[model samples]
Each structure stands twice: as C-alpha cells, then as structure tokens.
Target: MNREKTYGIGELARDFDVTTRTIRFYEEAGLLSPAREGQQRVYTDADRVKLKLILRGKRLGFSLSESRDLIEMYDPESGNSRQLNALLSKIQERREQLNEQMREIELMQVELEEAEKRCLDAFDR
Candidate 1:
C-alpha cells in the first residue's frame, strides 16, 4: 500500500522557515487547508505545495487575494493555459509598478542630492 506522506504544522514551519503562527494565519486566510488528526493538523503534499506557492507569491509582491485568485485559477484539465495567461498578466503588472517606483526613487534621490548640496554650500558660507 502506498501511503502519502503527511507533515505536521511544525515540520512545515521548519521546512518553510516560517513561524507556526504564520502557517496558522495562512490556514485562517483559507490559503492552506490541513486536515485535523485529533489535536494535530496534518498537511498533505498538496498543502505543502500551496504553502510554497503562497510564500513565493509573497516574495514577488503579490497580495494574498491575488495569490488566492491565482491558486484558484489552476485547472490541470485544460492544460492550465488560463492560469498561465493570468499569471503572466499579473507579472507584467507588477513589473510595470516596480519600474514606476524605481523612476520615482531616482527623482527623489536627485532631489535629496540637490538639497544636500545646498546645505553644504550654506555651511561653507
């Protein structure tokens, strides 16, 4: 009999380098649904995969809702084309936002440099 490997909350937390509270928070947010074995939560491989994806999304600046939407869009039946397309769109949007922020930061840095120069010149006088 092939038994699927299960993970305890602590095991997942350790593997993901996240706190147990963070895992619980993801559960509360409906991002992960681990089964309860008496008092212990048992996570399946699917849950682990979801947790990994959630963390990856967070690192990529995706909001929880956006990640949730992307996760929900997964459908292996139709070759997952729709999900791939949606993810690509989201990636493009995030890239555009980051570019705009970079531009704004460059402007702010120039302004700060000018302000510092003026202060230094005033001090020199």
Candidate 2:
C-alpha cells in the first residue's frame, strides 16, 4: 500500500516563499485546513493546491473574500464551468478597475510634469 504525501507547514511556507504566519492567516481566514499533529500543522496536497490558487488570486489583485468565493465555486466532482465563468467575470472587472486607475495615474503624472516645468521656469526667471 502507498501512503499519500503530506507536507509540514514550514515546508509549504518555504516552497511557496511565504512566511508561516501567512499560512496561519490563511487558515484563520478559512482558506486552508491543515491537520494538527501535536504542535505541528500537516497539510495535504489539496491544501497545497488551494494555497497555490489563493496566492495566484492575490497576485492577480483579488481580495481575500473574492478569492474565497472563487475557490468555493470549484466543483471537481461535476465540472468547473461555473467556477470558470465566475472567475472570468471577476477578471474582467479587475481589468476595468485597473484600467481606470492607470488613466488616473497618467493624468497625475502629466499634471506633475506641468507643475515641475512651471517651477523650473520660475527659477529661470
């Protein structure tokens, strides 16, 4: 008989380049459920995958709640159409928000440059 592979919290943290506290925070947020082995936390592969998805969602500008919702939408036994559609809608919304922010930043940059030019002209005068 073969035993399934499990990971320690430290091992997962190191592999994922995150602190143990971050993993603990995720657990507190109900994103992960690691089994307690005495004083240690042991994570299964499913937990690892969920952590990976959570991290990916964060990197893509997803809020923790949004990420949780997306994760919960996964139905592996049936299919992933619902999850995929929901994720796509979220991605679109994020892109729209980012685009608006980018526009605002560019406008600010132009205003700053104009102000700097005015300051330089005043100094030259």
Candidate 3:
C-alpha cells in the first residue's frame, strides 16, 4: 500500500509560491493549524486545499476576515447549513457589486474613447 505524501511548512510555501512568512502569518490568523513536529510545522493536503481557497477568496477581493468566515464554514466540526446558505448570499452580493463596477468601467471606457476622438480631431485641424 502507498502512503500519502505530507509536506513541511517550507514545502507548502513553495507549493503555493508564497513566502514561509506568509504561511506563518496565515497560521497566526487562524486560517491553518498544521501539526508541529518539533519546531517545524507539517501540513496535510487539507491545509493545501484551504490555502488555495483562501488565496482565491483574496484574489476575488474578499476581506481577510470574510475569507476566514467562509473558510470556517468548511470546518468538519461545525456542520451547519446556515453557513452554506450565507455563503450563497455572499456570492450574490459579490455578483451585484461586480455588475455595478462593470457599468462604471464601461462608462469610463466610453468617456476615454470620446476624449481620444477629440484629440485626434484637434491634431487633424
């Protein structure tokens, strides 16, 4: 039988392409709880998955505390549909915000295009 591969903190940091200090910071933020074997921290695949989700949340403009709240929903100890439903609501909220931003960006693009046209017309005159 083959055993699963576990990683140390350094290996996990390299896997995520983040600094060791960053991983430690996440631990400090209560995002991860890796086992401490001696002075070194060991991570499981579960931790890797949580890290991926947390990073994705950040890229999507989620606040750290919001990400933590969402991540906590995945905790095996707390099995509640309330969190899942709340996350769905949050997704809808994010969509609404992005839609509004898109409208603003479109408006800016049109304004910029008009400005460019005016500049070109002046150069031709």
Candidate with top TM-score is: 1
Supply the global lDDT for candidate 3.
Answer: 0.86
Error of 3 at 97 (Å): 1.5
Clashes of 1: 0
lDDT of 2 by residue, 1-125 (tens): 98879999889999999999999999999999999889989899999999999999999999999999999998987688899999999999999999999999999999999999999999999
For model 3, what is the error of residue 116's alpha carbon versus the real structure, in angstroms, after optimal superposition? 0.9
What's the CA error at residue 83 for candidate 2, in Å? 0.5
Clashing pairs in 2: none
Give the poorly placed runs of model 2, Cα more than 4 Å off. none
Alpha carbon lDDT of each predicted model: 0.96, 0.96, 0.86
Give each model's clash number: 0, 0, 0
> Candidate 3 has what TM-score?
0.82
Ranking by lDDT: 1, 2, 3
Error of 3 at 91 (Å): 1.3
